[model samples]
Target: MTSTPLPSPTSTSGSTHRSPARARHLLSKVPEVTVWFWLVKVLCTTVGESFADWVDARLGVGLVATALVFTAVTAVVLAVQMGLRSYRPAAYWLTVVVLSITGTLYTDILTDERGVPLAVSTAVFAALLAVVFGAWWARERTLSIHSITTTPREAFYWLAVLVTFALGTAVGDGTLELTGWAPGTAVLLPAGLIVAVAAAWRLGLNPVLAFWAAYVLTRPLGANIGDWLASSRAEQGLGLGTALTSGLFLVAILAVVAYLTVTRVDAPGAVDEPGTR
Candidate 1:
C-alpha cells in the first residue's frame, strides 16, 4: 500500500525525470515556456485572425469551403507534427499557426455561416476545453506542459490548444458585438486581464493554471490587435489591411523561430531559461 509520490515542482531540466528508454522513446514535444513562447503564440494568434479572414475573402469560396480547406491542411500538418520524435521549432510552430487558423475558421463558420450565436459558440467551446482538460487530468493526473512527453499527452495538449483558440475567438467577437467597442479599445480588456493573471502567478498562483489562463487570453488579445490593424479608420483601425498585418506578423514569427532553432534556447532540456540567457 505504498503511494506514488507527487512530482516535484523543481524537476531536473524543468521536466520530470524518466528512464533512458522512456526518454529516448518520448522526447518532449513542446517548447519550454519562455518569453519567446508567449511572443510567438501571440503572433500566431494574430495571424489566425487576419490570415483566415484574408484567405476567405480572397478565395471567392464560401466560409464553409474555406474552413474545409483549412481543416484538411490542419490534419496534414498535425499528422506531420505527431510523427516527429522530438520538438522542431519550425514544425511545432507551423502546426500551431495552422491550428490557430483552423480554430478561428471553425468559430467563424459557426457564427457567420451556420448562424450559431457567438454566446453559444463560446459556451460550447468552453465546455469542450473543460472536457478535454478533465479527461487529460483523469488519465495523466497532471496538466503541466513539462509533462508532455508522450503521444497521449501531446494529443491532449493540441486538442486543448485548438479549443482555446475557438473559445477565445467567440468570446472576443462576442464582447465586441455586445459592447459595440472598437477593435483597438477591445484589445485592452484581454491584455489587461493577461497582465493580471501574470501578476497572480507571481503572487503564488499555480504555474500550470497561470499558463493556460494567459494562453487563452492571448487569442483574443492578438485577434483584437489584428483587427485593429486591418480594419478601416471608420472602424477605428489603422487600415493596414489583413495582408500587410499577416505579412508583418509572419515575418516576426519567422525571425523568432529562426533564433530559437539556431540557439535551441527554448528547446526542452535547455539550461538557460528566458531571463537567465
Candidate 2:
C-alpha cells in the first residue's frame, strides 16, 4: 500500500482553522475569567443565599416551595441564555443569579427540609459534580471553561455550575454545623482556601484545575459572607435582615455587570482563557 504524506502544521487545505469571527463566536457565550468575574460571582453567591432566605421567610412558602419558584425562574433565564448567539451581560448574569439561588435552595432542601445529613448532601453533590465533569470530559476531552462555545458545552458547563453551588453550600454549612464555629470566623476558611488556590494557579498549577478549585471555594466564601451579613447579632452576623443583605449584594452585582457591559471588559478577547463557568 502506498503511504500518504500528512500536511504540515501550516497547511490550510489539510485541515481547518477557525476564522477570527468564528473564534469570537465560540468564545461569545462565556465571559472571560478575570478578577471582575470572581468578584461578581461571589456577589451572586451572596445574593443567592440572602435572597432565598428572604423569600421563604417573608412569603411563608417554606423551603421546598421557595426552591421551586427559583427553579422556575432559573429555567426561564437559562432558556434565554441558551437562545442567545452572543453574550448579553444582563441575560448571562441573570442565569447565574437564578442558578445560584436555585442551587442554594436545593442544598437547603436536602439538609433542612428532608433531614438529610449535610455530610451526605455534600458527598452527593460532590459526586454528582464529579459525574458531570467526568461525562463532560469524556465527550469533549476538556474541562476548560474558555471553550464554552457550543450548546452541549454550555449545558455541561451549567450543570457543573449548579452542582458546584450545591456542593459548596453543603460543605460550607456542614463545616459550620460540625465545628460550631461562628459565622464571622467561618468566612475566613473558604476565603483563605481560595487565596491558596489562586496562589497555586499563579505558581504553575493547571489553570483549568485551579480555576475550578477557586470556583468551588467562592461558593462557600460568598455563602459565609451572606450568613455573616444576614444572621442576627446573637448569631454573630451583622444583624442585617435578609432583605437588606440581598438587596446590597444584588445592587453590587448589577453595578459590576453594568460596568462590564459598557466596557466589554468580560468579552471573549478581553483576556486570556479566564472564563469561570
Candidate 3:
C-alpha cells in the first residue's frame, strides 16, 4: 500500500488560523470563568477583610471611618470599571477588592456599630442578596458571569458580589459566635463546605447553582484564612497581624492582575461556550 503524505507544519498552523472577526470578538470581552479567577478572587477578598481590620484596629482609624474611606475608594474604582467597554483584569480585580472591603465594612457597621446580632445581620444580608439576584435575573434574563458583556449585566454582577461579601462576613462571624471556635479551627468549616460544593458541581450539579454556591462560600473561606493568619496567638492565630496579611494578599492579587492584563489570560472569547451542569 502506498504511504499517504504527511501534512506540512505550515498547513497545520494555517488550518488553526482564527478569523479576524472572531479574534476581535474574543479580545473585546472578559475571559471564560476559570480556576484562576476564583483563586485570585478569594485572595483579594481575604486582603480586603484583613486589611480593613488592620487599618481600623492597629492604625486606630476606627471601623466607621475606615468603612467610609473604603466606600469612597470603591465607588471611584467601580466608576472607572463601569466606563470600560471590555474587562481588564487589573480594573476588574481592583473593583472586586474594593467591593470586598466595602461590603465587609457594611456588615461590620450593622453588627458592631448598630449592635445587630450576627444572626440578624446574616439573615438581613441573605435577604438582600436574594433581592439583588431576583432583580438581576428579571432584568438580564441571565445571571451567568460567562455572559457579562453589557453594562446592565456588569452592574448587576458587582451588586451581587457586594452582597455576597457582606452576607459571607455575617455568616462566618455568626458561626464563630455560635460554635465559639478559634480562628484556626473556624477556617475548616467554610473550606470544607466549598470543597464539597466543588465536588458536587463536578458530579453534574447545575453550573449556575454551583458557581453561585462556590462564590458565596469563598468569602467565608478567605475571611477565615485571613483571620487565622492575622489574629494574635492568644486568639489561636499565626500572628502575622492583619496589616501584614492584608499587604501580602494585596501584593499577590496585584501581581496576578498585572500578569493577566499583559497576557490577556482571562479575556473573553467565542471559544468559551456556555455549558449546563
Candidate 4:
C-alpha cells in the first residue's frame, strides 16, 4: 500500500481553520480512515449493543439509570479525548465504546420505557442526525473526518457520531419490529446495504457521504450481529449470551487497538484509503 504524509495540522483551508483560539494546531483528533478503522468500529458497535444489554439485565439497573451512568462516563471520556492534542487508540476507542453504549441506551429508553413506537423513534433520530449534520457542515464547511483538526470540528464530529449510533440502533431494532425477522435473518439486510454503499463509494460516490452512510449502517449491522450471537437457539441465535459476546468482542477490540497503537499503522498519514494499503 502506498502512504502519503499526513497534511499539516492546520493545512486544511476553511473558515474554521482561521480562528485565533485554534492557532496552536492540533494533530488530527481522529485516526486515518482504513480497513482497520472500520473493523474496530463494527466491533465497538457490537460491544455497544451487547455490553449495554448485559449491564442492564444482569445488574437490574433501570434503563434510565443505566443511561445516566453511561452518559456521565461518556462526558468524562470525551473530555479526556478532547484534551489530547492527537489521537490515542486507547482513549479514542474507549470514548467510542462508551458513546456507543450511551447512544444505544438513549434509543432503548425511548422505545422500551417511554412506549414510543419504533417507527417514531427512527424518524426522530433520523431528523436529529440531519440537524446535527446541517449544523456541522454550515459551521465547518466540511464534514470530512480527516479534517477534524479544530476543537469545534471535533465537537461536531463526536456529536454526529453519537447521533449515528442512536439512529442506527433505532433503525436496526425498528427493522426487526416491523419485519418480525429473527435476529439472524435481520443481519442480512444491513450487511447487504453496507456492501452496496462500499461499491458506490469505489464507483465515484462521495467519500464523505459514503463514509457516513456506512457508519450509520454499521450500527444496525453490529447490533444485529450481537443479537444473533447472544440470543438463545430458540431465538435463532448461538446462545452465547450477551455477557459472553460482549467479552469476546471487547477482547477483539483491545487486541486490534493495541496492534494499531504499537505499529501506528492506522495512525494519521499511515494509509489514506483502504485499497491503497
Candidate 5:
C-alpha cells in the first residue's frame, strides 16, 4: 500500500490522556480501612490523655497553663498540616495528637476548674458534637473520611474530631463516677463494648454507623488505657507515671508516623480522573 499518512498525533495524545486518567482514578481511591489506621488512632488518644496529665499534674503547669501551651502548639502544627497538598502521615498524626491533648484539657477545665458536673459537660459537648455532625452532613452530604478531598471537608473533619475527644473524656469520667470503678476495672467496659461493636460490624452492621460508633468508643478506651498505665499501683495501675506514659506513646507515634510518611501509606485525595466525576 502507498505509504499511509502517519496517524495524527491527536490519536496518540488521546491514548496517553486516557491512560493517565485511569491511573489517577486508581490513585484517588481512598485508603483501605486498615488495622494500622485504628491502631494509630488509639495510640494518639492515649497520648492525649497521658500528655495532658503529665503537663498539668507532674509538671505543675496547672490546667489553664497547660491548655494554653497545647493550644498554641496545636495551632502551629495544624497550620503546617493544612499547608500540605497531599496526605502526610507524620504531619496529620502530629496534628491529631496535639488536638487530642487540647480537646481533653478543654473538657478537664470545664469539669475540674469551673466545677461543671460531668453530666452537664457531657450533655453540652454531646449537643456541640451533634451540631458539628449536622452541619458537616448538611454541607458535604457525607461524613465519611473516605471522601475527604476538599478543604471544607477537612475543616469539618477536624471540628468533629475535637468535639469527639471532648465528649469522650466527659463520657469516660462520667461513667467512672456512676460506676465507682477503679481505672483498671473501668477500662474493661469501653474495651468490651468496642470489641462488641467490631464483632457486630464484621457481622453485617452498617459500615458508616459502625465506623462512627467505634470512633467515639476509642477515645474512652485509649483514655482508660493511658490512665491504667500511668496511675499508681494503689489506684490499680502499673505505676508508669504520666510522664513515662506520655513519652512512651509519643515515641511510638513518632516511629509509626515516620514509617507512614516515608511509605506514603495513608495519603488521600490524589488527582481525580476525567470520567471519574
Candidate 6:
C-alpha cells in the first residue's frame, strides 16, 4: 500500500514560501510605534521649522544654501539608513530630521522666494504625494509602515515620507496664510484634528487610516509649535526666538533618542519596554 500523493505545488501552503531576499528583509527596518515615537517625531518636525529659520535668517546662511546643505545631509544619512540591516534610532531619526528641514525649505522656496501661491503649492504637493502613494501601492500592494523590511518597500516608504513632510509644510503654511491666524490659534486647529483622529482610531477607525491621518496632521501641529515658540509675542508666539527654540527641541529629541537606544523601547521586533502605553 502506498501513501496518498502530496498536493500540487499550487496549493495554498506555497503562499508562505519566501525568497532569500525577502527572507533577509524579514528583519524589520523601522521602529515600533510607541508614545516616544510621537513625542520625538513632533520634536523633530518642530526643529525642522525653527532650525531652518535660524540658519536662514538668524545665521544669514540664506534659504537656497541651507536647503542645499540639508539636502546633502539627508542624502548621506539616508544612505547610512539604507545600509543598516535593522533599526537604529540615531540614523533613522537623523534622516527624518534632515528630511524635515529639506521639506520645509522646499515649501519656503516655492512660497516665499518664487512667489508661488500657497494654494497652488498645496495643490501641487498634494498631487505629487498622491502619485507617489499610487505608485508605491501599485508596486507593493501595501503601504503599511510595518512591512517596510525590504529595500523596494523601504525606498517607497522614504519617498512617501519625504512627500508627507513637504505636503505638511504646504498645508500648515497655507492654513495660516488663508486664515491669518496666530500661531497660538493656528495650532489649535491641527491639534484638534489630531485629537479627533486619535478618538476615531480608538473608536474602531481603520488603524492604518488613522495612523496616516495623524501622521500628516502632526507635521502642521509640530510646525506651529515651533513657530509659536520661536516667533515674537507681537506675532502671537511665546517669543523664545528660533535659535533657542531649535536648541531646546533638539536637546529633548536627543534625550529621547538616547533613552530609546538604551531601553530599546522602539526597536523593531523587540519586546515593548515595560510600562509603555
- Which one wins on lDDT? 4
Q: Rank the candidates by lDDT, best first.
A: 4, 1, 2, 6, 3, 5
Candidate RMSDs in Å, in order, are 6.4, 8.9, 9.3, 3.6, 11.3, 9.3
What's the residue-level lDDT of 257 in candidate 6? 91
- The residue ranges of model 2 lying beyond 4 angstroms of the native Cα positions read 1-27, 272-277
Minimum summed lDDT over a 10-residue window in model 5 is located at 1-10
Number of colliding residue pairs in model 5: 0
Each prediction's TM-score versus the true structure: 0.90, 0.88, 0.85, 0.92, 0.83, 0.88
Pick by TM-score: which candidate is best? Answer: 4
lDDT, model 5, position 82? 63
| Model 5: residues with Cα > 4 Å off, grouped in runs | 1-32, 58-61, 269-277
lDDT (10s digit) by residue, model 3, range 1-277: 1111111001122123333342222223344466667778789879867977877786567788888888889889989987877877888888888888889999998888899999999899889989998997676566666555566667777888999999989988888999999988998999898788778866767666777877888898889899999989988899998888998998899887887777765566423333311
Ranking 4 against 6 by TM-score, winner: 4
- Model 6 lDDT, residue 202, Cα: 64
Whole-model Cα lDDT of every candidate shown, in order: 0.85, 0.80, 0.75, 0.85, 0.74, 0.79
Q: Write the per-residue lDDT of candidate 2 for residues 1-277, one digit (tens) a residue.
A: 1111111011121123232342324445877666777888899999888898888899798999888888888888888898888888888888888898899999999988899999999999989999998998776667766666667778888999899999999989998999999888999999898888777766767666787888888898999999999999999889998999999999998998888888887775565432222
Tens digits of per-residue lDDT, candidate 6, 1-277, equal: 1111111011122123233454446466777766677788899899989998888886567777778888888888889999998888988998888888889999998888899998898899889988987886676666666667678878887887887888899999999988999998899999899889878766767665677777777899999999999999889799999999999999998998988888886776454322221
Clashes of 2: 3
The residue-level lDDT of candidate 5 at 13 comes to 23
Clashing residue pairs, backbone N/CA/C < 3 A, model 6: none
Candidate 5: what lDDT?
0.74
Task: Choose 2 or 6, whichever is better by lDDT.
Answer: 2
Which of the predicted structures, 1 or 2, would earn the higher lDDT when compared with the native?
1
